[model samples]
Target: MLCIYNLQLTQTHHFFHSKKGVPFADYQGICNWLTRLVQIENGKQLTCNRNFIAPLCELCCASSLQIGSLMHAFDSVKSALRVLEESVALNCEEETTKSCIQYLEAVPWDDSEEEEIVKVASRLGPIAMPIVARISPVDLTATRNVFLSALRFATSSPGGEGSGLPFGDELRTSAQEQIEYMLGEDEETPLVTADDEVRSVARAGLAQIFSSFQTIISCSLSETTETEALHIVSDLVWMCNVLPKMDMMKDFVVRWTEASIVEIIEDNRFESIVWGLKVKVIEVTVKVLEAVGYGTVILQPTLRVQLLRTWLPYIRKLKPILDAKAEQDPSFGHRMDEDLCQNIEGAIVSLILALPSNDQGEILAGWMSGEQVKFPDLSEAFEVWCYRTKSAKRRLVEGGLDRVGNGNGRIETTEMRDMTMIPSAMVLIADTDRKESLAVKGSRK
Candidate 1:
């Protein structure tokens, strides 16, 4: 009774006209009073006026109503939480959301209180998603089952409205959101906490996705039926979107050509589905190359050479064809994504840069060789390689990478010729036979 009478003394509602908004100084007082209302030991809290929610929300945007201060009592916590949720920004710019997450993370559940929260969650929607997302883990089989369902919808062949059937864009939107959240690329924290665990979960999901790929390839081999060939290509590409971000998948990309269907890549004369699948292949190749190429996963010079050699010709040939098709018909689904092309160029440039100057020249000689297909425009890689070769020894001496510190307290200079991890952005002149190759590399175009 004393708490109710005291809170009523404060003119909490009149201070905000809904036009000028609540005065900033009044924020602390309102929060304090609300806490008192919830904290009252007498059951008067059950009957407190619920009318002030709107003006209260206005102040909540900048309120000092801490999450910890309310958790002691369910009535108090729920009352404060209702106001806090009204205030929390989706971008997490508000202090209330942060404190709430930390409190929920640290404290054990008030199951009865959370039942009310879960009810609030059902009505308020994704704004309440963070609590459910963070609180607990679902069954592994349940997780994999939903993933597989999304995988199926995603992998189904591109066709009419009837083909997509019950859930079209909504399923895709959910899958993409789920993927981003699982990968920790979402605005909220990753559903999985540890990086290793995230990767392990990701790899398990990738394996399930890729296992379907193996099935598709094996079944598609002899006849190349539409059902076999095209049905799962989208699934492969869908999973490819995940590949570049995984550090362990470098070997998968390096050894890719063995499992790859050469006919689809080699023969561009195929029908639209096959052509689309071809573009899908290039997309996957570009992603994996990025995984290994951009210093994400290190490879020996020989592996780097192999990676470039395997995919170079296919990309060189496919590049112009994709552009010409898109130019010829704007509606073509197999058209080149400008971003994918940019990644291809960038990934190739990094791989080329990692090699010896002579290998770079030889590899680049293959580029722009055919006048008809000068699509990738390797001039960036060529120019950077040339500049680095000329400045090799000087930059090596300057950066002190020319010699290595050994356990025996010795500095090694001559063995530095094999150093592959050159800092090309600043002073990346790999001493790996750069001196010997320059004369030979210089003589060529």
Candidate 2:
């Protein structure tokens, strides 16, 4: 009831400020009332009650209040911070801790002040790890700390204790949002530098996520409810999204295409717990492959092949099913928009063009034989692959050669007396008169 009243006061302040012409400072009486929620008397501290704990948290809340510097009494309030520190020390209720954390996160450190905020954040130790991520953008130490913390929740067991806890979900949700926002989610371009140091963070995070996924995957889906299973699927999708941003797409392909995950994917019984998960996995795979194939996410030749061979079958079978289902459906819950469909198709075609002819032939043959034939309609990749492979010799002869620089032919062979005869070959010819004379003499001889 006290927590509810505390929230109502903030709402009441907003109501007067927005509706009436009064400023937030007009609520000075209310602010002073809430500020005293945490106090000490007779050489003893108050605010032991859970209800007052949240109200004390609310007193220090409102980033705008701190930013506006209204209500001078609430401006430099340290009691809330004291309560928060004590709460963390006591390992208090999740709601109180979360509210305190939220209040700290809301503080306008960069805009208003930082001395006290940084001190509290540092004193809070690892519990304030996520706050450091938001408050300090260029602090790699804080970024790495948050990344490690994010990785911990990212790799947590699906049905573990944290899975059911309110604060645990907050942490997990914070983990997801922090990583994305830090990496530049809605921005025009990625904010991540992906430098050597950042890559190291990604590498370590990748290793832990792999180990956690591998461990949790061995547990039967029947052991978890649909919600829990979906949570794990969401984490895996989160992994998929983060990998491409960090230039770890190829690394992910190597791990996910391994037999352990394949066994789960191949077991496509409709009623089985794996079905929903399998579909979502393929959805993320399509996006991953799209990134890799479109060159947005660069990868080596080998991992591209692994991605195609492992997920192509599923992509082929599921594209139509995805098209048939609405996002409102429980079974196929994801929204596969038209742009996504085109992207996957184009990406598949791009990858197909990169493969050897024999492999393309095998993939195309399987596509033609199954119900998947008309779904992905890889005829774009198929037709292009055939023409590229069959006309390889002709195109090579016709397209001629690229002359990057006029340099001496390293081979020193006089076989090419007429450079025009080998338009197909990119023989680097140094424009040196001596080499040309030597080639002519050698050919004549």
Candidate 3:
């Protein structure tokens, strides 16, 4: 009926344009021709023929600037923009697309002119977002290339400043919504790997998106913007391989803390981001312990007593991993069993020998009376114990130290002549705070 006749009329319009030397009287006539031609079902095929689209391209390109300017006279910039959008859409090849973008970019902008484009782009953002999602996976490499180029041009071009228009915001949000939709796909989906050109494009796109997130977090205006920025940061942090490069992320962790970010990393959500982040808690703890010795921090005797009585049970769970190499090699395991205790005893012997002989009684009395006993030398003493234990393990494996069989599952070593060595290591570490207290008291006196 009417629909079939209208379709035939559209095809006839395409046939008219496809022929060479077919000329329209003017730009209005050219637009009218294109309007009829666009209604053709095989318009893409006709346009692909090059000759068919020559008149339309001539209209879109040759008079693009004048038509854009004329667009305001009829209050028809909307139609101009639509035609430009359509002209680019029909010629889906790279060179044509580039020419189309160049023409649009070259369009003259005044306060009123740019405002209209920003309004249209903003209204189009949500519609473009869903379209990108639906079609991304089928041809990710091609889609990503186009998207990356568009975003680059959107974010980098300079214009529309002080024009009472929010073109920058509209362009940024619209382009970002499209990029985010592609990246938000399920993990199981296979990513497109077309060729070197395509991957290079994808990498550049991901880097730009990641940089945008970083810029947002570091430079955002307010709390709400920062929160949105954090969401973006969280996404990149989880998706990328970031763990090995710890220092690069320190500022991000500090920002998270300052921003009062308290969310625990869930098992699945942002798993990559979480796994990639350097362990902030462990890094902070080690730094604090180094600057302020063990006893002055969490290991102060009052806390140490509680921690040993309570937390040691938890810490023991980690011992197997720490002790893995010692047990794996039986020769080494046997040597550790034979010499560890005596090696520890030798360190204590050297330390006790160096102490003022008469002060030994005072030290003993302090310990016996339950007074605050000081271990000024505990740090060096602890280092020696660790070294000796590791060395003994190595020596047993090397057949340098003898081992005695013990039925218990625990690796039993030969008994030291001085059994006090084991308990003294703990005592020295626990008593380090008392030495600082004594120094403070002496200074006051």
Per-model TM values vs. the true structure: 0.52, 0.52, 0.20
Clash totals for all candidate models: 0, 3, 7
- Residue pairs clashing in model 2 are 407-429, 407-430, 408-430
* Tens-digit per-residue lDDT, 130-217, candidate 3: 3123223555556656755654543332222322465755654455455445444454222423345534554454455456554543
Minimum summed lDDT over a 10-residue window in model 3 is located at 239-248
Model 1 CA deviation exceeding 4 Å by range: 1-176, 185-231, 243-247, 255-258, 267-273, 326-333, 393-418, 421-445
lDDT of the structure predicted as candidate 1: 0.57
Q: 1-445, model 1: which lDDT tens digit per residue?
A: 6555435433443333232332344445655656555555555445444455333544343343334443332234455455546545223335555555444434545778777766766776765677666455676556555654554444334342335557765565467557645555543233322245545555565555555565555443434554545545555565656544444465455446445555434643453345666777777778767766666666667776877787887777776777778789888767667788888887877778776667788888777576644467677677667666577668767878656654444343645535654324212443343444555668885
The full ranking of all candidates by TM-score, starting with the best, is 2, 1, 3
- Candidate 3 lDDT (Cα, whole model)? 0.38
* lDDT at residue 301 of model 2 (Cα atoms): 49
Clashes of 3: 7
lDDT of 2 at 230: 62
Residue 363 CA error for candidate 2 (Å)? 2.4
